[model samples]
Every structure is written in structure tokens, then in C-alpha cells.
Target chain A: MSRRILNLILGCASVCVGLTPMRAQEFKLFERTVQVHGFASQGFIYTNDNNWLTMNTSQGSAAFTDFGLNMSTQITDKFRIGAQGYDRDLGQLGQYHPSLDWAVADYRFKSWFGIRGGKVKTTLGLFTDTQDLDFLHQFALLPQSVYPTDLRDATLAHVGGDIYGNILLQHHLGDLAYTVYAGHRSDSKYSGYSYFLTKYGVTSSSFAGLQYGSDLRWSTPLKGLLIGASRMNEEITDNGNLSLGPGIDFTSYSAVSRADWTNQFYGEYVIRKLQVDSEYRRYLHDQIVSPDSLETISDVRGWYISGCYRITKRLALGSYYSRYSITSVAGGAAAPFFPDQTDTSLPANHVYDKVISGRVDLNKFWSAKVEGHFMNGYGNSSFPDGFYPLANPGGFKPNTNALVLKTSVNF
Target chain B: MKNLRLLPLVAFLVLLAPVRARAAQVKIIANPSVSTDAISGRELKSVFLEEKNSLSDGSHVEPVLLKSGPVHESFLRQYLSRTDDDLRNYYRVLVFTGRGSMPKELGSDAEVVAYVAGRKGAIGYVSAEAGVDGVKTLAITDGRSPVERRVITRIEPEYPETLKRLNIGGIVRLQVTIAPKGNVENVQLLGGNPILGESAVAAVKQWVYATAPSRTRIEVSVPFNPQP
Candidate 1:
């Protein structure tokens, strides 16, 4: 026989011999269990205005298509590992990157507690952790007003070591389940866009921060109905150095309450607020704009109401209306950060936006969604400016309306 | 006058013969290895429903049931105070939730009797008239002195007949009192559908058994047959 055929035959014979019973009455030994699963999704997004779509920021709304692959495996009862990669084009910019999403060993003491040490993803809000794989959730895209960060980026989520647990309390008054986590998040400087900008001779900074968050959820059975309330808090440290002070440090708080009648009808309302303390620094061909500090404090408030109906066991339909507004206060004796900048007509920025979305679940692993956004106020645009090569665009014009359609799948 | 008197005497003897035979026909036996007296109906019901998985001696007990048909229906009604339909549905829910497994069903009373007798941990019920040897006949109710048959009506005058009809397939909860001589004295419907409640009470009252005294709660459903 050929060498390949000989090798194949030998392999099969070895496997058979390895599985043979060793003793006449002994129970079988040599156990093997293996499972393989993953998912891929790709979809196109178009914009009504090409210029709005082409705006460049860490994440911008541009018409493009993206796809990603994620695979995980349980090496044993206590250990799991996973990896994911995504390639996408947003308006004018394109990217292709792969990263380790989950590489952790979870030791579960009981049903309510576990300590996971390794690179772990933190789930804060309802859809915070699963923001990627848009196909798996109800919205075509994440709620931009709430999850303003890019879902495809690793820096937006958590990585590092975490200890998480849940406490369940049953009392005469009600039932409560609280989940809390404390962890230090670390990422390679290359995980953020600043690293790339810096490589291109543009002034940028490195970031590494600590995150601690907790969520308290309570549900009470009232006359055969379930009513629930939830509160969450997240705090992050300044991980970079800006000309003003350190880098932007922020604290976010969210509160939500919901009522569910049976498993069919449910309604929830959530409010989120973020406090940002940072400064704007100027650069002249990679030189500091000023030697003194120019501090800026920005605050954003957003909220939404959503309702969902499960039409069938594997199908559901939902709708949500949400709004977000941001205000920034600039302080310290400062000159126009960029003298070469052209759009000098603007003052301190503010933005207001409203979005209405509807979604349909096609299956447990897939969903389709469509949404329309009505933005009225102009705020600091997260776009790069053309006038000053180093000064990023800081404002966007208001009264822009756009519609989006998205689909996602997960395995 | 002489012929009429003779006819009356003969009628009395004929009626007494069947009653005597029925009383004599009742037999109780445990498996050869089992040392205890036949279980009471209440204990049997508890064992079959898994409310208790062990007997007084701490021996594990497993109940076998007929898969379907008249015997299954009769067994459930006589012991569980539930219709076969309701029992089957409840078991399905339990099995789905991993609470317990459905009892193994045999083909017929003969099979059920043989299986229960041969298996050390097995228990099952068959017709009082099956005349099967080896297996035991648990008393339907415990007491002595021919207990008066008392029909405990559960339905009010205003209950709908349709609901009453459905109650035939619904669960009937009853609290029963058995005398020390194995005679049933009183039964009260603790809960259940109002429609079939009367028939259930009536059927239970007519049940006769010979066993030790015991007071226990039981649920049984008596099915209605339009053809009968």
C-alpha cells in the first residue's frame, strides 16, 4: 500500500487497540470527549449621506460590511479557551485583526459562585458583554447612545483577571439576585487606535486601567407576576497621559426596572450616565500645543424604554425608543488648540439624538433588526479633521437622520 | 303461605352466598421474602406516587404500573384519587423536570402480578377478582364491622354539569378514616373538582377491604362511562 494508506490504516488500528478493555470484568477506562463549534456573520450597512459615513473615529457610522469568527472549547470541566477575529470596512477605513477573547479557568464552587482567572469578558448592562455578533442580539447594531464604543474593538470590553459571584436572597418581601465583579483589566497598547496613530508619527498615548463593577437585580412575585429592578456601576482609571492632566477618567452608572407577566409580555426602562474628565492638548507637527494644562469635563446622559413579546418558543419581537445627550465644559486659559484649524466658528459642543428600533428573532442563534436615528444637536464629532493633521475633529453638525438594517448569527 | 315463606328463605340464602363468597374471596399475601402484612391503600398510594420511597422497614420500594387501559384506570382511581389521564400528565411533567421516572408498565394484570411477586423491590395493584397467586391484595381501606357506605358529595347544587363531567378526569383529594378492623367509616373531599366529586365519593364508599387500621389522606378519581 502507499505510505499515506499505510499511515491511515496504522492510525485506525492504534485507536481500536487503545480502546480495548483491559480486564474481563473491569469497567471501561480511557474516556474521550470532544466538541467543535463556531459562528460567522457578514452584512452590509449603507448610509444616506456618504460624508457622514466616511467620518473617521475609532468607530464611525459608515456604510460597509463586516464578518467575524469565534470558536471555544472546554478542555476540561474547569477550563475553557476561545479566540475570535473580525474584518470590516466602515465608510473609508478598513481593519482586520484577531484577538484572544476568552482564555480562562473557571472553578465553580456551587451554582451561585465562581472565580475565573485569566482573560475574561465583563458583562455590565444587559447587552454589554455580547455586543459583538450583532446577529445574536435583537438590535441590528448596538444602542449607540448607550454603548458608544466600538463593539469590534478589544479595548471596549474587559480583559485580565476577574472574580465574579451571585447572591440570591429569598424573603417574605421578595427575591433578589445580585451579581458583582472586581477585576483589573490590562491590554497591549496595540489594542487601541492610539497605538496605530502613534506609529504613523501622530502624537498618541498608552492606556491601561482598572475596572470594578456591580449589578444588583431584584425580582418579586406579586400576585403571580414578576417585577424586577436593577442597578449597575462601573469605574475606570486614567490610563493615558494628555497635555491637560492625566488621561480621560470616567465613572458610569445605570439603573433599570422591569415587569414581566408570565414569560410572554415584558417591559423595561433604563437610564445611564457617564462623567468624563479629560483635557484637549494641541500639537504642532508632533510638538505640544502648550506647556500649561487645559482641562475639559464632559457629561453624557442617556435612557431608553423597550418592550418585548415572545411570539413562539424560538422567536421574539421587540421595540425600543432611546435618547442621548452630551455636554462638554472647557476650562483653563487656553488658545484655539489648533491655529491651523478652519472650523473655528463653533463653541463648546452639545449633541442630542433619538433612535427608534425594531427587531425579530429568527432563531436562537440569529436575529434581524432595523433602526432609524433622529439626531438634532451637534456635539463633539469623533471624526478626524483635515485642516490640522494632528487635531482630531471635535464636533458634528446636527439634524442628521439615518436608517440602518443589520443581521447577526452566533453558534 | 308455605311456598311464599320457602321462596323468601331461598332468596335470602342466595343473596348471602355471594356476600359471603366476596368476603371470603378477599385474600392478602406478601412476597415470600417480605415479612410485613399487606400494605394499606393509603400506604400503597404514597409509595406509587413517590411521596415515600421506602417502607416501614426501610426497604426500598418501586411501584410498577400497567401501561394503559382499564386496569391502569382502575388502579389509579382505587389508590391515587386521580384519573389515569391526570396521573399520566403529572408523571410526564415530573419526568421532564428530572424529578422522577415513570413506573415501568406491564402488559396485563397477570404480568403485573408475576413481575411484582418475582421482583424483591416491586409493588403493584391488580383487580380484586384477578385471583393471582403469590402477589398480595392490599386493603382498599382499613377497618372492621361492615362499615356503612357513606357517599360524600363535593358538588354544590349550582355547579355546572359540564364541570362535573370533567371532574371525572380531575384529581379528587380525600381524607379517609379507617377503623382498627379495616372498616372504612367516613371520607371527606378536601379539594378537587366539584363535578365528579359526588361519584368519586360514592364509589369510594362502596369499596370494602380487610386490613389493619390506619387513617390517611388519599386522592382518587372515578372515571365515568357513558356506555355503562
Candidate 2:
């Protein structure tokens, strides 16, 4: 493994120098502002007895890959159109093929109001828009607690429109951005979301429904300080990922709030070297499976704090502490095959993930990173229609460790 | 017949000479379609850097730049407050983030001036002595305070031959204190090469403006371009 890692580093460095990156080829098309950009990334993950993100992680897997090509054109000073095609193969999830990630025709009437229609990126938190932009993050993965990788498509974007605008509060010396969007999102049947369900005999389940949400961000007078809140309501119908034995159905609503602060303590030539980011996300779930037969309510919450410091112009070091817990789960007793259905204190139901990462810029468009995780619990279990491959039986408490190496380039 | 053969060569030199180290004066000019004739230096800076689309008067604007030249260098340093490489990197990040797009870059003062003159809402800068046939020259002053009135005529600084040959192009900065009566009281070099610094200082010393009671200190950048 060490030899492979060394070879990967050497090969990418050699290719990066020879690569003719398209990052700087931006020019007007037909005398209009049209810019094209794209990026690709690959990763290898190895874990010790933790069947998460993929099957049989005890050995290792290189099934994580992401690619995207995007272009945006400014038709006028106030009107713009942009779209991106995305593809990913995350172990047993994602189609491993291209899809219309987002395509929008955006029109800004003024500084105070704008309208965006078409497939739009979800307004979740600070990380929503740039989550797929690997080069933007110093960590191999953003905190899964706040940004679960498995929930990408379900939470990635909406197929509708959004009305967004900014409001200025002169006396307070701060600006507020508000966005309201309504649309529907789908959960892939082949994804882990469905895999977990199909394993329990749920052959037919639809996680698509009308979801509407709003996100608000307030920029305080302090230059780098911002506070944001996002609220969303989703009415979904699923069979509890269970068989036709009185199939289950339910709806869910969630709200996420976060704060982001960035400071420039060093390096102004290009990259601003140091940053600290933190976010807290909580979701409330209410499921009335089988109509009057059963009712369930629960709350899941998580938060994380991470800091990145650039030691040099080309090297960056980062560390983060993330914790997720199923604070409470009730009424699942009505659903078929649900054990410990009335309680949330079940073992392996929570997890504390600590990570350390190092990234090196091979060149202007290529970068590589290595990340290690120390886990204290197997709480990532979400077997019944969940992404994680852990099924905690006998209240097993397992500790695991994992390492990953990733390389990416964008232009 | 003998003189006729040399006519084209002489005319070519006259145009090519300014692209070299002969830059001395620069005039901020705008297309005829632009409705705003008076704009603050700060507002002008914002438009060219792709920060804002409209001037304070609500008129839209398009910023055109000389690809590489002493005047462009000086304009970026004094107005936009960034180095050449820094500006390019800035645009790259903007394009990458979808915040802004890179402005158009033309080759010479004549080209920029002609473009500005022909294109609606277009604005650019050229050698002050360069003929601006169809464009309108904007009035700018080092003083934003209540002290100095607007500038009527401006002078451009000569490009340093040594700096040009060495290809060490950048914006040279200076701090000028305007007297209450609009006379240039003092000029202090803030940043950039000393050779280019001297030329910039000499030209700014002769600038005249309307008068007020208190003096104003204006920080300016004089740029040197070595690329054709």
C-alpha cells in the first residue's frame, strides 16, 4: 500500500507538469461572456473491519470517483445561464455515469432581487454549493454529519425554481441573503438508500415528493463572520424499505443552521492560508407507517468543527472533530422488522469521527491529499434503507480506523 | 520618391514607439454611448475590476484594458491597487467562483481607444497624448475630499527604459498631498521601481485642480508595461 501511494504521488506530479490545463483559457464566445470549467477526482479508501462507504472494507476499495464539467455564459450584465454535468461512483452507490447536476437560467433584476429557474442547487448550508468541488476543501471529505455523502442526490439539488435576494440593514452594518425554493428530488433506487431498503424486502419505494425550503444568511459588520439558517419540509412516501406486508409510508422535515468564519493571517499571493469552519445540522422525522396503525417521531442531530492551516504555499494541514447521534427514535415499533423501535439508546447508534488530513498542490490544477480517521463507535449504522453497511446486533460496540488517499484536478 | 518610401516606416514607428518605453501621458476615456462623464476614481476602479456593473449614476459600463503596457500597469496599480500577476490571479479566482469574468484585453492605446469609442458603455485608458478622436476623456483627481476640484487635463508618466528592457513590469505607487488651492504640494513614492517612480512623480507635480480649504492625500499607482 505504501508503495502504491508513493507511485501515485510520483505519477501525478509528472503528469501534472506536462498537463496543459484549461483553467486559464477563458475568453468571450461570440463577443459574449462565456466561461467553461471542469474537474475530476479519484480516491482510495482502506478501513479496518468497518463496512461503511463500501462492502468488505476490511481489505480496501478504490471505488470512489467524481467528475464534473460545467459552463456558464453571461448574456447580459444582469442575465446568466449555467449548467454542469456530474458523475460519481461511490462504492455501491451512484450511477457511475453522467447526469444533469444543475442547469439554471438566472436573472438578477437588481442587488435586492434575483430569480433562478430550472434545476437548482439546494440551499442547505455553506457547503451545499461547493461540496462536489473537491479542490475547494482541504479535507478528503467534508464532515459527514453535516454533509452525508450518501444523501448527495436526495439533498443535492431541486428540480424547480428559487427566488433569492439580498437585504441591506444600514444601521446594523450587515447584509442578509434570503432564498426560497420549491421542487422535488429523487432517491436513486440503485443507491445505498435503496440498497439498504431492498435488503429488508422493500422492492418498491418512492422517496420523491414536493419539498420546499428557505435559506437565510446574515453577514455581520465583522468582515469574515456570517450566520445562516436553512429550513426544509419534505413529504415523502416509502414502504419503510419493507415488503408488501402492509407497506409503510411517511413524511420528513429538516432544518439546518450554520456559521462560517474565514480569516487571512498569511499568504496573499494566491491562497488565503488559514480558515476555521463549523456547522450544526438537525433533522426531525415523523413517520405514520400504515396510516392509523403506527406513528413514529425522532430527532437526529450532528455538528462538526474543522480548522485548516497552510504550512507553505503548496502544503496544507487540516483536522476536524465530527459527532452524530440519533438523539431519539420512537414509534418505529409499528413498522415491520424494527427492533428497539421505542428507544434511541441502542449501541452502535452513534459515532464520533475524528480526522486528520494533509493536502499538497502538485501544480496549478492538480492536488493530492491523504486523510486518516479514528472512530470510537459504530454509530453510523443505518441498515434499513441507510447508506452505512453496519447492522449492529447484540448491541455490538465496535471501534474502527480508516485511511484514504485522493487526487484531483480541475480546469 | 525618396521620401515616400520612408513615410510608412516613420508612421509605424510613431505608433510602435508608444508601445515601447515612450509612454508618458494617459487619459481615461469612454465610449460615446456612456451617459456619465464624471465618475469618482473609486467607482471607475470598481467597474474595471468587474466588481460592479453600473456607475453611481445608474449607467452600465464595460471595461476594456490594454493587454500589456505602461498605462495599463499604472492604471491597475493606482486605481485597482493590485500587481499584474495579482490581478490575473484575482480574475482567475473570480472566474472559477462564478463571481466575475475577465475583462477584454486589447493590444495598444489606439486599439483600446477605438474600441472604447465604438462600443457602447465601454471605458478604457490610453496615453494622454494619444489622439482620442471619438471617445470622451473622463475627469479624475487625486482628491476625493472636499478640497481639490475635478481635474481638467492629466499628464501620463514616461516608461523607464531600463525597467522595460528588463521586463520588470508592475504598478508604481505614490502618495500625493494636494494643497488647499489645488497645487501639488508634495509627492512621495509608496511602491514600485525607483526609475519609474521618478517619472511618475515629475508628471504628477504639474497637475492642476480646483481649490478648497483643506489638503487631501491621494495614493496613486503608476504602472510600467514591458509586453507588446
Best by lDDT: 2
| Per-prediction share of native contacts kept | 0.00, 0.07
DockQ for candidate 1, C-alpha atoms:
0.04
lDDT on C-alpha atoms for all candidate structures? 0.42, 0.66
Off by over 4 Å in 2: A1-18, A24-34, A166-176, A219-221, A239-272, A332-347, A380-387, A390-397, B1-52, B61-149, B152-228
lDDT tens digits by residue: candidate 2, B122-189:
88998755678999877554425423345555688877664565565655557777777888889997
Chain A TM-scores, per candidate, are: 0.60, 0.82
Best by DockQ: 2
Model 1 per-residue lDDT tens digits across residues A124-222: 444445555454445565545444433233223455444443332333333343444555554434332343333223333333344455544443334
- A1-411 in candidate 2: lDDT tens per residue? 553454355446534632655443466788875677777777787877556564345567666777776778888877778777887777667746578888888876655577888888877777766777777678888877777776676567888888887665555465677888888776666556566554444553556666678888876766446777887777655543244345545333221112111111111112245667778877666655553245545456668888888888689899999876664343444445443332334445666789999999776677789999887665543322122543322233367788888887776
Task: Single out the weakest 10-residue window by summed lDDT for candidate 2 chain A.
Answer: A259-268
